[model samples]
Target: MAIKIYGSFRSPFVMAVALAVYEKEQEFELLMMNIKSPEYMNNFNPFGKIPSYQDEDITLFESRAIMRYVATKFEGQGAPLLGSTFSEQALCNQWLEVNGHSFTPAIVEMAFSKADTESSKLAFEKFEKVLDVYEARLSVSKYLAGDSYTLADLAHTPLFHIFMAVSDDEKKKCLTSRPHLHAWIQDISSRPAWKKVTERPENTFYKPRTESQ
Candidate 1:
């Protein structure tokens, strides 16, 4: 059976999973549903999350897990996303954890929150700290897990896209001021797989915000 991903591209998590599938040189059907519907809750994600994945061998929820599965299942086909060496693999998992638990929370807050409020200010402060960690790591390495572009690098593409789209100049500087981090962002976002993901029709929801808007 063809793989089916139950979600919308508006969700970065969904986009990340889709990017992973593309990186593995596989195609999937993007399906949508009322996530709160009983069928979705029961069969897809009980939590009613946007991205749930299904393939011939399994049904899964959670975008990161789905990405891992796709990377491993099709490991030989496309870009080697899981890392080429034991140290690289270990570092890949480590950075992926940081991306999920630390970086995502800070950036998501800053991206969606109204600027200039005390809360937004605090969020930016936190996000900069997270960016600093990335900058430091990236200063010495071309990719997050090393020279190889792994899932650690892939996971951040959609999040950074949304961040850059919505962030004001000050907030944007947290990323841009760091030369290495900015360059790394450019590198990862430039991949053919990520380009394909962004060019998809379902990607309409997160267009870059204009000043007039």
Candidate 2:
């Protein structure tokens, strides 16, 4: 059977996994499941998450783990996503952890929290600090993990896409004001695989809400 991904594009985690598959020159069938159902919980994810992956070899949950598996399984197929050197690999893993722990929380909070609220203000502050770290790191390197685009960079594309779509210009200045972070976002978001993800019909939900809208 073809690699099957049980989730919807409504979850950026799911899209990130799909992007990883594409980067590895692989294709998968996107499926949906009642995450709370016993069958899904028992066979796929005990935690009941939207994205669950199954292939001939393994069944998996957690988007980052799935992406890591895809990258390793297809290491020789397409873009070298694990980085070229030992140091780069180490940095790749480090930044992947950063993406998970440091970056994701703040962005999610900022995206979902209502504007002009204390919670929103706190989220923005935290997110700005994280972006400051990225700007400093990206200013000297071409990609997050190193010179090559690694899973670290790939992990961020979907989140940034969602953020850009939902944020107003005033809010977006948090990203745009940081020249390096803005440039890195442009570079990663422009990838053909990401373009393919965006073009999928299932990805119709996160349209940018501009001032006019």
Candidate 3:
């Protein structure tokens, strides 16, 4: 059987996993799991999360871990996740953690608020602070892991993609206010594999560009 990615497009975490698989020249069967179902909770993710990866070698949860595993297991096939030098690898790990801890939450909160789910100004303020840190770090390096594109950079792609599509102003905020962050997002978003993902038939939840209408 092919590699199975259990989740839906609604979950950016799952989309990140799908991005990684394609970046590495591999395809996966995206299986949406009923997060409430016993089978999903028992066999895929104990946390009952949307994204759970399963392959012949192992079963995994946690998007970051799964991305790391895929990169190492299939290192030479696609974009290097570990980095070229020891310091680069360290920086990669640093940014990946930063992505998980600092970026994801704020982005999620802000997006939900944009949808009128609840208040999110506090989340937006928090995200601005997080972007400050990113701006500082990215000022020097071309990519998150110094000169190379790593899983670190790949990890944050999907969330920003969705966020940008929702609002042109938000897209401008995410990409332009900070010089390096903007460049990095553009670079990753332009990749062919990622383009393929956005084009998939099953991907129904599209937030169109403001100019589309």
State which candidate has the highest TM-score: 2
How well is each residue in 26-130 modelled by candidate 1, as lDDT tens digits?
A: 999999999999999999999988899999999999888888999999989999999999999999999989988998988888777786799988887888888
lDDT, candidate 3, 33-60, per-residue tens: 6887898888888788878999998999
Number of clashes recorded per candidate: 0, 0, 0
- Measured with C-alpha atoms, the lDDT of residue 153 in candidate 1 is 95
Model 2, position 135: C-alpha lDDT score: 96
**Shift of residue 167 alpha carbon in model 1, Å:** 2.2
Per-residue CA lDDT of model 2 for 1-213, tens digit only, reads 799999999899999999999998888899998999999999999999978999999999999899889999999998889999999999999999999999999898877888789998998899999999999999999998889999999999999988888778887898889999999999999999999889888888798676531
Off by over 4 Å in 3: 114-119
Higher TM-score: candidate 2 or 3? 2
Q: Where in model 1 is the C-alpha error above 4 Å?
A: 209-213
Q: Which lDDT value does model 1 have at 185?
A: 89
If candidate 2 were superposed on the true structure by all CA atoms, what would the RMSD be? 1.8
The whole-model lDDT of each prediction reads 0.89, 0.91, 0.83
